[model samples]
Target: MPTSRELREVKAHFYSLAGFPNVIGCVDGTHIPIQSCGGDEAELFRNRKGYFSINVQVVCDANLLIRDIDARWHGSAHDSTVYHNSFLRARLDNNEIDGHLLGDSAYPCGRYMMTPILNTSTNAERLYNVAQIKTRNTIERTFGVWKRRFPCLSQKLRIKLEHTLAVIIATAVLHNIAIQQNDTVSIDNSPEEDIISAESNMQPLTSEGNHYRRLLLEQYFM
Candidate 1:
């Protein structure tokens, strides 16, 4: 485990290079299945998918370099709830983050975490969503690179859940190094496919509910 000082240094350096002032990083949770391990510890690994796994929470900077991460929770825990229970909550409460972190709708919007819910109908709301999408893409892209580069993350590993977290962190640090070193990186997306994907994922909204959601999001983000 990295000492507190070392961890702090890493986070500071990461945010500095990322050029996002006061940003603690983008936070999200993912489930990683683990093979059967007997006892109460094993119980913590069960997920809503009816699989055994651990919930991994990561905080990455604007540059997509992980500043801090936690992976001790059971897969069954909600991501938002996990954030509340994790050290990240203390960091946010203590004002350790310069600005609120960006997250997906799975997490509720808070002073410490900014999330966008499809609650808008105004032209202004449309603009805000566009802006949010642009910034939020960074985190999604980072996850893509992280998972692709770390094949072990895509498959089951022999290590204990706790030990596996260390491996994950080490991988994140290495990913940062590659990004810092100016390594070749490419992102792929087809405009047509993207449109289709978005259409499939979009939720329908009632006129009144849409208006309210749009107004609420505008007020909150503004």
Candidate 2:
């Protein structure tokens, strides 16, 4: 496990990247399929498709150093629900996290977290969306690196759910270490990726979510 100070340092360094401020890091959850363990224990890990799996939530900075992670739940749950019940909830509720979080549309728009809408047309929003897309790419890239480096994550894990979290966290810690060494972590990218379509699903925040996001953005932007 990383010391709290080390985690904070990683968080601060990643958020310091250009155009990113007060950012605790980018947060996302990935599905990790697990082998059946049998009995009631088996049902808890079984997902919608009857496949045993766990949802791993990770928060990483601009450099892809994971600062915080939560990986104990089954994959049948929704990402938003996991986040709502996560430690992120406490940090967000107390206004402890500094900058807005980046995530895919699986998460809804809210203060301290931003996701592109399904439709947006204004020029300013367009520009803002562009920057978000660029920054959020770092997390996806990190995931690719993680799956590649630890082939165990690319396929079904034979370990029990409890043990799986430990393995994932250990891998995250090592990933950050490798990044510090200036390792090459690459993900396949199309030559002509369209930023607009990539972010097209972004929607305006609802009154509550929008007001909260604006307040957080203002606090950091200022």
Candidate 3:
């Protein structure tokens, strides 16, 4: 978790990119391929893509440094489900964090989680979507960098499920360290074949969330 001062700095950096205010981090999920568990629960590891893997939820700052990660969910789990069950969600719900996270439409919009608007008829709405997408793309780029740094994440991990989970979290820690040391990999020429598309099963926003988004648009995007 970031301190209050650090969260403020992250929000400023994100706002500078697209004028999206109060954004502390970008959140998303990625599937990590792994060998089958070889049991009744083996099928549980198979995702919609027909691959056995783990659905890893990650939150990254504007600097592409990972701030949070949950690698315990199976590949078949919905991105929103994983987030709802995460410790980060609890912290956000408790107002322990001062800023919101930018996620795709698959997440339920709330005071702490902002998702893209589905229907846009006004120029303010359009601009809001554009800024949201631009700001939210950091998580995607962070995944690319992390996977490129550790090929094991991109490839199938032939280890036990317990070990696989440990490896996933360990790599994320190493990724942050690499970023801090200015030791980053170039993902410019990376292929897009491995990139997972954003889930389209959009979740409904809370009444408070809808009102908050509207306020944001009127205050900033307008």
Judging by TM-score against the true structure, name the best candidate: 3
Which ten contiguous residues of candidate 1 have the minimum total lDDT? 190-199
**Candidate 2 ranges with C-alpha deviation above 4 Å:** 1-21, 41-44, 48-50, 190-204, 212-222
lDDT of 3 by residue, 57-123 (tens): 9999988999999999998998989999999999988889888899998899889999998879999
Residue 105 lDDT (model 3) = 83
Q: Residue 85 of model 2: what lDDT?
A: 88
lDDT of 1 by residue, 1-222 (tens): 223455455445434442322334566776666776778677667776677766777776566676667877776776777787888789668865445566666665566665555756567566556655555556666766777677677567678655877887788889889888876466553121111122222323335434644454556444
State model 1's lDDT: 0.61
Question: Model 1: how large is the Cα RMSD against the reference?
Answer: 7.2
TM-score of each: 0.71, 0.78, 0.95
When superposed on Cα atoms, how far off is each prediction in RMSD?
A: 7.2, 5.0, 1.5
Q: Judged by lDDT, which candidate is best?
A: 3
C-alpha lDDT values of all predictions: 0.61, 0.66, 0.89
| Residue 4, candidate 2: C-alpha displacement in angstroms | 11
Better of 1 and 2 by lDDT: 2
Query: Which residue pairs come into collision in candidate 3?
Result: none
Count backbone clashes in candidate 2: 8
**What's the TM for model 2?**
0.78
Supply candidate 1's per-residue lDDT for 114: 52
